[model samples]
Target chain A: MSEDKREMFDEQDDGKVKESRRDFLKKIGVAAAATAAVPAATAKAVSIAETLQSHFELMSDEQKQKAIARLEKRYSEQFGKQTTVANTPAPDGVLFGYALNISKCIGCRRCVEACVRENNQSRDPKIQWIRVLRMNRGNLTFDPKHLNEGKPSSDPLGNYGIQSGGHADKAVGISGEAEHYYNPEQVPEENAFYFPVQCQQCEDPACTRACPVRATYRDPNGIVVIDYNWCIGCRMCQLACPYWARRFNWSEPVLPNEDMNPKTHYLGNRPRMVGVMEKCTFCLQRVRDGRYPACVEACPVGARKFGNLLDPESEVRKVLATKQVFRFKEDFNTEPKFFYYMD
Target chain B: MAEEQMVSVGRRKGQDEVIADKRVFLKRAAAALGVVAAAGLTGTAVIQSARKVGGTNARARCAEEDVRQQQIMVGKQLLLMTEGEKQQMLDRILSSHSRKVS
Candidate 1:
């Protein structure tokens, strides 16, 4: 062996020395422990820092920047996909609003499936943010007779009727007056009209008021958001929302690598752990980047409209003016930003 | 008076020049570190983050797919929606919100 290579034991390199099996074993044990200790220590430190992080509102500009970088790195490793958790503040002079042309909804449920993929909502038990209620014309209640007796509401829809629509009312506490929700093979049921309901992102959010920890609150841009870490998952906000907008994460979010939307925002679709409340941020992840919400883009009929409520020329604002806009449960006086319109 | 005060114009030491002076070296190091930290916080780039996107993951490789393959997009001309769904949309337009049982 060469002079340097011969120092495998290195006993003679430092002067007269010899190797002992005990010493060698002891050294190896320490090396092994150190190797394990590094990652363990790093992980513990990260969790400690996460616990110390201030709320988005409370963070200073410098602190918020650091927080965004930290969250982006953390999510990148966890999902094995590149993620950018931007802390893009709600744009000034912009309050996002949504208006869905109910006359155009076909009850295709494309929006529901799109949301499942876009928002990282659980697939197994199925948490749907947008609930499309297939109601009989002139009635807000679900009636199964549209499909139960194998009779359609009218015309070609009745002729082609299959089965669906029993999921929305009960979840939102509309079941008392509405009994039957049938999913039917085809929709619009001739006599039926569909309107999707999600987080109204109320101008006066009852969910925000109901939050015991004040984890859920409306940001300056008029988007109601949840601070995942601060949320105790007491579910006070869930019960408080007349729209049933908030959802509890009963378990750690299981996101498939290929299905994960790499583009994420800190206040938006970045995945959550087992026991936090999540709700629609109107696709803050995408919208802040000047892109449309997943459901808005996915609608084939071009029914779902979204834009800056502050911009007079925005599509949503135009729809609000030109169409007959209606708010669900407006009697509750929550002042929901979400509007349903028929043109 | 503050604006009128004379400011000294001095030659900036090169990266190599300040090596012998501990305080100057330390101050220079701190300034450089601050710039690096700023770049990192911006997530613009500071020697390319270890957890950057387009790392060796298969999900990173999936970006090679065409834009149409993306799940979320606007005004998609080719409908992934079914024929029946499209027909219903057309029916709504033809009927003009008054699809009468009559």
Candidate 2:
């Protein structure tokens, strides 16, 4: 609206002015369209590349960065919220460990619900990482005859008296099987115990070895994880795991767009498309950030303990040192980092 | 004697579908003795086993290094406990479940 600017515009050659302005407008429109299309177009392109992408180990640093950024943007669009997807590697000199005080767990299932929410597991089919097993408190022992009769506790700690270091070890007390899959109105069942089981994150993981493609593997931080995009959903890991920790996504996970956890780890809790195997990663997204696992935060009774096993002063190292700790199936030689213990 | 006892245990199972109530109590007492004998008794062996919790050895198999480690562990666990939990832990370590009997 300045007089000099208006005069300059008016003085321009009418024919040339129309031509130049039209060309400028055309350039500006094309530039804006390309800028807008890049992310949407790139997002679509990234999805295709992601399926065909090399194993994370084989990708270069630059390729990994681009892939992670695109994934964050794409997930943000899909979930309609700000999303953060990153590949946070485990710090050196830290080997993670977890312990559960079986007697302290009240079978509240708060941890189970917390896991479902944190991991973006299916809502309708209800994929859960942690399973709290209600077992009768009686004389239980790992009798060889019982092992011959069936698999040694497909229910993991459900029949915990036999899991070692309890009154059940001597075969001296009451005799009965666990009243498993027990869903009661009120928990801390009379004369009963609760044993919550999840991925042991084995030192020598059976689930990883069972993977034909090495899709499921243990991280340097001692967490057994599945690369969801690489998984073929063969369910071999499920069969190999003594703890029965692996879960298969039968249908695309039913998490609502709004409900999905926007904070995700590349090998941890990102929302998975159907046909992949998933198990607990000890809330890798949170733990790598120096926070407790979601389930551990939710547990009201302080039953769960997690810390760096390599650190001499950490809770997990001290617990294993002073307490009687044992694996679910020691004979299987999985060498699980998870332990059931009592002080 | 160990072989005979095992054979007798097998025989008892073969003979009866249900162990008699008196037999169950007798078996528990004998098993309790076995636990005491098997603990490789150190100083705390007799008292702990006598409590019918012979499977646990309070000072069993711990070396000097393990003792240090356990001490450090106790310090760490104490930090995690609430005041109430700390009291319960104190109670457990200070005495057996004698209060439960009363």
Candidate 3:
């Protein structure tokens, strides 16, 4: 063993140890230099830092040009292609509107899953783009069942018999006696309806008001938009929203590569970064580009309707005119483009 | 006036040298770290972080056959659910929504 070790050590020697050391150091230097040849991170970091410092609109002409260039460069590195942020033109004489049929909505949340996969939504439990509220019929006063039915209710038998009031003394006041009055048999009732909620895309948006930087705004087509590069991640818009439609990405999204929709829309379902607030842009990317929203496609029941409200020929306008519609939080005067019709 | 002038000149010279040195140091460090980070060493550390940010999603480690397999989560417990139940749930949602559109 010792003879073999000696032979290995001798092979590393190049007539003299000092000469070999020099050669070894040279090899390391060459490898490191080759690695460094790729422009290291000097330019990328500087551009990203510059983006952080500037108010997008306040930026000088030169800075604006730099920002556009930086965005193009960064997106290419992250997504393997140079992404162009194109100006999506609205159809002539078009105004977007959405309607949901409450009677047709089942507690099963297929739309929610479809929206998440489409929008490249974050995996955080709090980051759901759509929420399905399950409410029991005839429970006018305390609607414990009306609570956010995000994940299916805990197995009603194993965990069901326990009343909400019995869960805690504090729950008693909040849930009231109606919480304890739940019957296992009353579940899966025919009268139950699932209400899926997302950004109402209000005609007069509250979120737009909350953005101190005016990063978010309503475009001419009445769709609310957030300029991601301009967003400061202050989360003020979330607070201002009455319907709780806005979702903040505390961490990066976790989507499988196979499930990723390579087809992206800048204002709609494109992948967003951490610390940004995102909501349903009513699939503006799809609508403006003459495609349907992923949720609209995923609705097996065809409960969701999307079209232009301004065009007399549009289906959404026809639905609004013919059917009696209900808007959530109408008293708040958000003037939501979204409405619900009884099927 | 002469003393004040001398002091101001010395201070300006000292400040200029310090600023120049700091800028050089920053440039050198950025270059060095950037090279190391790009060799994927720094990025690997970020990838190790389970917390994902941006719109990027994680890749499924399981094979296609594995994806076809059904798994369920109840509270903290992991359970195997029947494929039939999953199909039923999906079918129920589709039928319910389809009925409302017309």
**Best-performing candidate as measured by lDDT:** 2
Give lDDT per model, in order: 0.62, 0.66, 0.58
Backbone clash pairs for candidate 2 read: none
**Candidate 1 local lDDT, A61-104, one digit each (tens):** 99878887787888788778888877776766677788887668
Model 2 residue A33 distance off true place after TM-score fit, in angstroms: 26
- Using lDDT, rank the candidates from best to worst: 2, 1, 3
Q: Give the candidate number with the greatest TM-score.
A: 2
Q: What TM-scores do the predictions have?
A: 0.59, 0.60, 0.56
Q: Which stretches of candidate 3 lie over 4 Å from their true place?
A: A1-73, A80-85, A124-126, A140-191, B1-102
DockQ of each: 0.01, 0.00, 0.03
Question: After TM-score superposition, what is the CA distance of residue A213 in candidate 3 from its true location, in Å?
Answer: 0.5
- Model 2 chain A: lowest-lDDT 10 consecutive positions: A163-172
Alpha carbon lDDT at A38, candidate 3: 36
List residue ranges in candidate 1 displaced over 4 A: A1-46, A141-183, B1-102
Which is better, 1 or 3, measured by DockQ? 3
Kindly list the per-residue Cα lDDT of model 2 for residues A124-172, writing each as its tens digit: 4566777776655532443433432322333333444332222434232
Ten consecutive residues with minimal summed lDDT in candidate 2 chain B? B70-79
Model 2: CA > 4 A from native: A1-46, A142-180, B1-102
